[model samples]
Target: MSNKIPYVNILQSAICIPVSDEVPIALDIKILPDKNIPAESFFGVWLLDVSGSMGGDRLENAKESLIEQIGILPDGTIFNLITFESKVNEIIKDVKITNKSRQEIIKKIQGITERGTTSLYTALEKSLEILRKYSRTNGSLAIRKIILISDGEPTDVHVRSGEENDPNYQKYFMLAKEALEYKSSIDTVGALGEHNVYLMYEIAKLSTGKYIFAENEEELKTKMIIATEQTARIAFSSPTLAVTSITGDIELEDAAQYKPTVIRMPFEKINKRESKAYLRSFEAGDTYQILVKGKIFIDKNNIQTETNVKVLELDFDFGKDGLRETKEIFITFSSDSSKFKLNQDINRKYANVFSQAEEIADCTIRGDAAATQKIQGDETKKID
Candidate 1:
């Protein structure tokens, strides 16, 4: 019998990070051949503090970031929103990421009044409960986590700010522990230089997640972007296929999720190397197909003049696995030929993401909820 070598479909994971307002980075996270992800699915929890302290542009920026965050989410992310202050509110009770519901949710967010004392602990408790309602054990996806945005500590009488005053602190600690124990990432986004940044950091550490401090509205935008990128790295940076080529078509789509084609990835991390691979910027109209995406420019006009532009490209024979485990990949914007040439052997420079998918493939995607997987052994048992 002639031996046959089946063309193994080594699946890849993609993650899109929408920073507060910086360059949007979508990374192709590499994983081994064993872990294959399907087309599109996203799962996450958003826990925000709407206390009076988080008013004005701070709240506005948070909403903006939420839109960006939600915009890139694939149809699969069974996301739920938790906002808190004196009390906690669930904006969208475990809803899938969609245009209509997300718009309605954003409108609800717009009506959020920043009133009442900050109740960080209470918020955490209640939000955790809301998330629990959507937990994997309860039939939610496995690749899930929490995003906590706040600028203060809990005002709950039970918990102490420090180890010094009280037994109630232990209870609060347990509450935090329980939430994290359930395998959910807890990323913290705090106001830049706010006195409560320390608390945010502490919470991040407790949750084994990312801590991001945004100093201003602009930085908040950037931080939001960074936060999303970081999440992408963590969730999707696992791929086996190495990209032999990359090109950017200079395109601008409004923050709205509807009218544009999207790249969906599960998770992405920032501080780590090899996790940063993104589609570069190029205008399809400015340059034709063969030369549309391979060069870098300080200015758009440079394209016509064809000045000193940076060129990076990838040409690899990664065998069956497509991508290797290397920590870096170079960028290649389709070039115009006649003018500029390639520069220093540059690798896709990876950077820090202080802070952090779509669709319905209908199959088991990577990080999917095991609770949804049944049919195990000799006997019959239910999944979840």
Candidate 2:
């Protein structure tokens, strides 16, 4: 038997919806690489906050988690650890994990202590600098990720004194853009309830990464481990799905990802007939379902009573080996109501996504940061 396997499998819901002016569809994407294929080199940068706010249990738990994470990383994985307060300190440089170096890395992680104020922006900037330097040397095949754990907002004099319009505050956004350019995602962990959830969320979203909120010590450790494991399993990097209208005057209305992680995906309209959405890197064995809503302007006089109407063509661009896979989705238009059943699973996902979006907007309008964070975390967990 051949040991080779396809890099990805794209599946769409079998059931069709009722023919109307607007129709919604769901696509389930599975990324599976052959076990015989060599694993990509993993590059992970940890930006830990050791500010005064992260004292006692917070710091201790973070240290314990870091040590545990180091033990589980695969051999030959490049790791860097940087802890920041008023100043940033690089405890471990770009060192590859091996049986011997793993122990030394754990010792350095155990030695991390808390003091001074939070310098979140500075720490992030330094991490990106390192990632960019190594990415150029390693080429585009390496899997690069940054895990930022913070319990408070930036308290550095420059960041605090500057408003959002100031250069200091705007630098974070620039860093996120650079991370994207470097093919590195920044997964952010808000260590405690007091952390700046909005800022962390934006950073993660901008970099095509996940944002996790840890309410307590145990969650902090567990969530960090999950984030690291996901990064290490990445098999496909920076894939984008292009949706092109095939029949009639069809326009994409909305789109959101429902599985692996629950978040609204931003899409760009390329032209009147096509649109594109940027998807996250796919981990091996990972399945993602995206709910896409589109509007079709139908002329009832010219409509066929019983036929399969092709609506959209999905072109998935997997950023490796110049592989581009395409799939066409069709809906059955019938006069019999019995044959026009909707996929309940897809319907539920659509409802949940929009409901949560509305709730988050309400929370934001009322200036309820905690509530907004809670809604995001709860919705993501429920879907996961």
Best TM-score among the predictions, by candidate number: 2
lDDT of 1 by residue, 110-196 (tens): 676677767777767776776676664565454456777776656764443333335665555465556555655566666644424
lDDT per prediction?
A: 0.43, 0.72
| Reference-based TM-score of each model | 0.49, 0.78
Regions of model 1 farther than 4 Å from truth: 1-40, 157-169, 236-384
TM-score of 2: 0.78
RMSD for each of the candidates: 19.0, 4.8
User: In model 2, which regions exceed 4 Å deviation?
Assistant: 1-41, 157-171, 247-254, 296-310, 331-348, 360-383
